[model samples]
Target chain A: MCQLLGMNCATPTDINFSFRGFSQRAGITSDHSDGFGIAFFEDKACRLFVDNQSAVESPIADFIRDYPIKSRNVIAHIRKATQGKINLENSHPFVRELWGRQWIFAHNGDLHQFNPTLTGRFQPVGDTDSELAFCYLLDQLAQRFRQGHPTLQQIFDVLKEIAPKIAEHGTFNFFLSNGQALFSYATTKLHWIVREYPFKHARLIDLDMDIDFSTVTTSEDRVAVITTEPLTNNEIWQAFAPGEMILFKDGKILQQVLTTVQRLEMEKKDPSLVRKTKADPD
Target chain B: MCQLLGMNCATPTDINFSFRGFSQRAGITSDHSDGFGIAFFEDKACRLFVDNQSAVESPIADFIRDYPIKSRNVIAHIRKATQGKINLENSHPFVRELWGRQWIFAHNGDLHQFNPTLTGRFQPVGDTDSELAFCYLLDQLAQRFRQGHPTLQQIFDVLKEIAPKIAEHGTFNFFLSNGQALFSYATTKLHWIVREYPFKHARLIDLDMDIDFSTVTTSEDRVAVITTEPLTNNEIWQAFAPGEMILFKDGKILQQVLTTVQRLEMEKKDPSLVRKTKADPD
Candidate 1:
């Protein structure tokens, strides 16, 4: 199992505050520490940093924690290596260029027997199921829209249809971004929070650190943070349903779909559905 | 014009010494400092770091100089921004995936009226003549070899056919790598050096620093460095011919091609044919 973190902002915003707490899971707070990677998009292009070393010990991660890079979209992952060997190629978040735009993807959950046929447009360089899934998703997008770039709504519609099919294999929690928006889907565990105007002081749950957002942010600044676990304790974090997908843009939920309504109804009927909480080990 | 730096090694070797001097040209020694980028390849994948800030002041560049990220194939660029805006997208050392292998490219010269038709298979995210050339080159390769990966020899042959056509538009000195080998083409200015066993002390021209390579490297280590200008004063650097292309692998020149032998014959006949030297401004 791995950990995922994503941020979409109304304006360019830095992820240092959230990443400091989130990266602690790599080795300090928990042991999801085979490798780690992060991508910060500057419009249609991004700066991708990856390392096979644990985030807690990597000098690159140390630089990231100290440097404040402002980006409207950011995706990060801490890997524990369920399938692939521990190397730089296997580190997430993975990136590919599609339709002249760079797309970034990171997976947190394991998939069983998830191989899919690819048409050679997008291929995985590393031998990881997560990267294979990412390539498949991009291939599907390219196949669907063979001409010009697809609209965000069109992409969202396609993802809403594809997420459940891939989730059927096993857990399929992922964060994907194309510099314009962030699409997050979860089959088991995920949580998100939106911080907008009238931001309050928040304390991190994983580390003994706190930040007063009001002091650092303008009223126009809005940010949406999605993660496997909530980073802060004071803020209200909303957990996704068993099978839910959400699209975030400009620091707000642009669209959302419940792929597994039948599962939710079954949970409603049966109380022993076994929903994982924040205190549960991932 | 921009500046280029590349390294191809028989073993994984760090570029700290060369990079320290090359980065000084960003703002300290010379002013090719609109932005800078570098790609370090590990197998078929690479870690690409780019910054809009000058390499002299960018924190990421500072970290790269301090931390030794060893790689067999590394391509770096310091941009002067003749064609595109000074931003992360237009920064050189552009990367794209073709045939499941990551291709890294960096251009050092400007191309005028060099718009080539793209088949929508590979597109440029940034608006630059250099990126457009890269996209066009990849599109040609993908079209030429549609089924599977092409051998390095085939790719080099295709490049030999394509480089001169692009150089016809204007100056087109560039460095390209696909993890397996490095292909360098020179239209105006480029230099290279290969260091093997019995290495001696080398002194940097840009900075007051020296390194005793014999003490730090093993006998098995062989490194080939390509740059816009010679970095060391003591080492013998060979300048590329006006239209020369070289393929380097395992720290040695695997193949060399003179695309414009007619021009070389003319230059030999006419002693007045001007050539840029080490002291000439790029």
Candidate 2:
């Protein structure tokens, strides 16, 4: 499996501090040292970086520990060997362009027996179930709204419909953005938080680092962070129920829906619950 | 290179909207078709995923779009081959057990020439600059403050001292987290923002989607989002100086420093501003 870190904000900021501690686990603190990658959104585009090396030990990673960049959204990843070879081509936080806008994405999970016949509108550059799903999703989106571009709500509705079908194959957890709002979903483990004014202090569980939020933000500033797990021991991180979907914009959630619209269906077909019973063999 | 997306918040939130637009670029919209990965923080740990496939077409990515795993801190990525082969051993959001905690990391950018001596305190499992640097950084941290544990501020200070030394070698920008606060830095390009209270409506530039944040958050929620670039077009994304370091906790900037304090002196002596000019390679 891999790790994910993301930020969605109302005002422009930088991600230097969080990236520092997160990169350490790539090779220094833990055993995820596979490959690492990150993307920084500027305006409508993004600056992307990737390396086929353990982030903790990468020279580029070292440089990033001190370099500072401020943006409204950012996504990052560090890898562990699973379902693919350790190489640059397989690094995460992929990017693409649609409707003249650049989009970025990352995932941390597996799918079993998920063989979808793609029409080749979007093809995978690497061999992983994650990519196949991404393409399939785009294919669906293109097909569903081919008459014309649909509204955000329209796309959201379709995503809700398609998510479970893909999850039937295996674990699916991911993040997506396009110089706009952030989208994330998890059939298994996923969590998130929003930070605003009157903020308090936070401490990292992996490294000894603390900060006072009151000092750096205005009453107008708000941020939303999502991750696979909690990054701190001091903070109370919330867990997502089995089969849930969420949308974020301006550092706040815009929509949330249960995996199944009906409660009875959730009890028997919730992969999130199954994740707790085991089955993360990637 | 790979792309990254991040979010930090005061209260728990989810990323579903931005991720949808972002993932489109992985293989469907644009072309970061190598692989993808992401992590979500809960309390002191995270669940991570990685795929050696383009996010735009990955089934895992699709599931991520539909599944909603709420998290406070989230990191994600999409990959394009830059170093190493296309394999899972090199996927990111690398994780490590450090100081009895799991640390997650992801990196972007490249290093031209960087090979440092390692004391074997940390080792690299793959042959990429990222792993080497990740290990070296841990070795330095372990050697510097191995006695019990240091404070988060102390850790940031230590990184402040070490970051620029590595940046001199090449472009380094990254995101790091330890299930606590997020640490970010950049030598060339990175950006960030904060959001709170009175959240407004926002739309994705890549995909046709708009989200009204007022409906999803309470008055108590605040968040900070950071990235290598701006994820939304309507929001303002702040750029980092040539060398800057910052700490993010509870969705706000806690500490700001200039890692390359000597950049002025170096610039004075250097005949060419090669470093600055080369940063924007596009």
Candidate 3:
């Protein structure tokens, strides 16, 4: 089991500062400490760094602390391995490529007997269930849309159709991206939030640090962050329901499709669709 | 410090199978069991799964054992603590938004008193040096290119310049992507390899599994995987020297740059540079 952190913004931003405080939980200030790694995005690409030597003691991990490569999107991981061996090759935030774009990914779950035939243009380079899952998904997309890639809406339908098949096998919460948009899904625990106009001060849950968003962003800029757990102690992070998928673009959700079970759940609490009319309804 | 795994393809792939065997190193089969998480890409976005619980004992992790969602890209982490408190907020594979694209990151090192100010534009929600660095890098990009966005080349140059500054504080190694390409940098320990056509049969060093990549991939397919250590026992992994950055597209190196010091060091190591002709051209 491990913790995951992610960021997406309307404008470019750096993750070094946040990472500085986040990496401590692994084994130093806390105990998840096994290893850690991070990836930073720059335009249509990203810069990746990883260490198997426990971010607490690794000199390479220390180097990452001072590095300030910025990107519009980024993903990070700290591990506490539960299944596979502790070798360098079995790290988090694995990467692969398909189509003409370079895609990046990371996983935090354990799968049992999850062998699936991967009939596509992509394949796994490692032995983790996470990588095999990545391959299977890409193969499905290719099989589903054997021609030109479909629009996001069309693809969303496909994702909805596919997410369940995989979820049935076991836990299937995850995050994925392709330089244009970010997709988040949860079968059990996942949460996310967006900070846009009128950004406010955010305090870290793992560290006693705060930042006033108003100082760094403009009205035209918006930001979204998703994680397995809330990174801040004082922010409202909406938890993802079981079997829910949300697509994000331009720093906000472009499409969200909850399992019928989730909608039915809301119906149980709110007979009408009006679940939580804000203090001042628009 | 940590390990990372990612996949990006033209089709969907399942990671659960591979992750099943990979998570063992986190304290079960190995000792990394601090925490873990994973993210999967569907289109422009992704679905992330994480567990503060050890991947071996957590019921959620157990469920992941059999799940099989396929994706185009994925990221996973196994922690070994360095900075932030362990509970949940400091978990790796962090996510955020930038320029409307979703991005993900993971880290594997520790830094000393390294914190950067995040403008209102982007602020890290976690408490780790890796996240802070991620945010700071993005803020810089936003400050430098506000009119439109910079090209990949432009961004690459910025990474080269900023990476060293951050490295000054501590070890800096990370993986990042908006989706299109993967950018990787190594200061002390990071290795990667591109797997495309002419694939071969690979076996896992930690688990009992083998796959024939030649049977799954096509000549048009390409993949680049970066990690703190090699995952497979038979794969050829390229080691990154300190102060080096490379851009991966379609699973291959598209461009590469090195710090001035790194270039000089390389020049000194290889006599071929000075001789202009090698005794054995082969």
Candidate 4:
């Protein structure tokens, strides 16, 4: 299995504090040493850094830890090579250009038989199941919206419909963003926390590091951090129920839904009993 | 006008030494300091680092200068912002995926009123004339070859035909690569030098730095360096003629051509006197 980390902020924020703790899982705290990658979204632009080397050893990762790249949306992953070979192409936090904007995706779970037909438009440059899934998702989006980019809610509606089809293959926990909003879906393990105005001092679980949020952030600043495991021990990390999908924008939950997995389970018992409302309605 | 630098090698080679001198042109040496970007290709995979910040001032450039990320093909650019704003999206060394490979492009010159009709498949995320030209080229390629990727020679043939149409708009010196080969076309200033088995010492023109290539390279290694201007003072850099196109692979020139600019000029003088052969035929 791999590890995933994502951040969405009300203001442009740096991930050095969170990344330092998350990167320890690459080789130091854990053995997910195959590869690692991270992407930071600054408005409509993005910066992606990927390496086949373990994050603990990669100088790029070290640079990232020290250099504060401010962004509103970020996604990161540490790979364990479940399906693809250990190479630069298979590194996570895969990115693609869609609707004249860069979209970043990172996956953390294994997909059993997830070979979906891909159109020529968005093909996977890397031979990884994660990349294939991302391509398929984009292909579907391109097909659904043949014209210009749709609204955020329109995208959410389509994703809610398609997320279940991919999840049917196997465990499909992922985070996706297009610099505007972040969408997270999980069939198994995933956790998220929102840090708001009265941000307190926080300590990391994997590293002996502490940061006083009050000293660094203003009252208007808000942040939402999603990870496979909580990076800090003091924060209230909420774990998702199976088949839960959440959309975040400006550090707040914009929308949430029970994906196909949960909906199907409910429908199998009683088709009419499945709830039409979202899982965690705003 | 901006500055362009490209490296094609028979073996995976680091660009730190050349980049040090090349980056100096971003601010210290000259003033193409609007932004800078570089893309390194490892097989079909590519790592692109771009910043709106000047190469002399960006921490990302500092990391690149120190970290030795080896690659077979590299394209770097320092922009003077002839046609676009100084922003991350408009940074050079733009990348797009096609035929299951990452295609990297960087342009050094300006294009006036160079807007080509774009298909929805490949569109420019950044509002730059250089990016628009790149998109148009890719769109034409995608249109010409509806199946899998064509051979390098086929691509060269198509590029030869289309390059002139874009170059007619304005100055369009560029470096393009899809990991397999590097293609350079010059409508204005571009130069190249190939360092082979009998490598010699070279001194940088922009900085007080020198490298003994004989000490760092093996007999099997060969490297072709292409840039806007010669980075080293002692190297035998061959400047490209106006409207000349060169294809490089395995650190050697595979093909060369006299683009439409030269052909059109020749035809205007004498209708039946245009040559079909390459400009610098060996």
User: What digit string (tens of lDDT, one per residue) describes model 2 on residues B1-282?
Assistant: 766777777777777777887777777767878877777776654656666677876655665687676677887777777656655445666554345344666777665445667654344433456655666676687778756356779878878888777666566677777757777888877888787878887777778888888898888777777766666788777887867877888778888887763333443444433322222110
DockQ of each: 0.66, 0.02, 0.02, 0.66
What lDDT does model 4 reach?
Answer: 0.87
The positional error of residue A260 in candidate 3, measured at the CA in angstroms, is 6.2
The per-prediction tally of clashing pairs is 0, 229, 267, 0
| lDDT of candidate 2 over A115-176, digit per residue (tens) | 67665445554555665677677668777765545666777788889887877766777777
Candidate 3 local Cα displacement, residue A152, angstroms: 2.5
Which docking category, incorrect, acceptable, medium or high, applies to candidate 1? medium
Off by over 4 Å in 2: A147-149, A261-282, B1-282
TM-score for candidate 3, residues paired by index: 0.47
lDDT, model 4, position B213: 95
Instruction: Report the C-alpha lDDT of model 4 over A1-282, residue by residue, as the tens digit.
Output: 999999999999999999999999998899888889999998888999999889999889999999999999999999776554788888878888888999999987766445577888888787677788899999999999999799989989988888877776567899999999999998888999999989899999999999999999999999999999989988889998888999999999999998658323422444342223211000
Give the per-residue lDDT of model 4 (tens digit) for B1-282.
Answer: 889999999999999999999999998999988889999999999999999899999999998999998899999999886544678988879899998989999987666545567787887787777877888899999999989799999999999999987776568899999999999999989999999999999999999999999999999999999999999999899999988999999999999998866333422344232223211000
Give the Å shift of residue B168 in candidate 2.
Answer: 44
Task: Please give me the DockQ of candidate 2 compared with the native complex.
Answer: 0.02
> What does DockQ come to for candidate 4?
0.66
How many angstroms is residue A135 displaced in model 3 relative to the true structure, after the best TM-score fit? 0.8
DockQ of 1: 0.66
Model 1 ranges with Cα > 4 A deviation: A261-282, B261-282
Write down the worst ten-residue block by lDDT for model 1 chain A.
A273-282
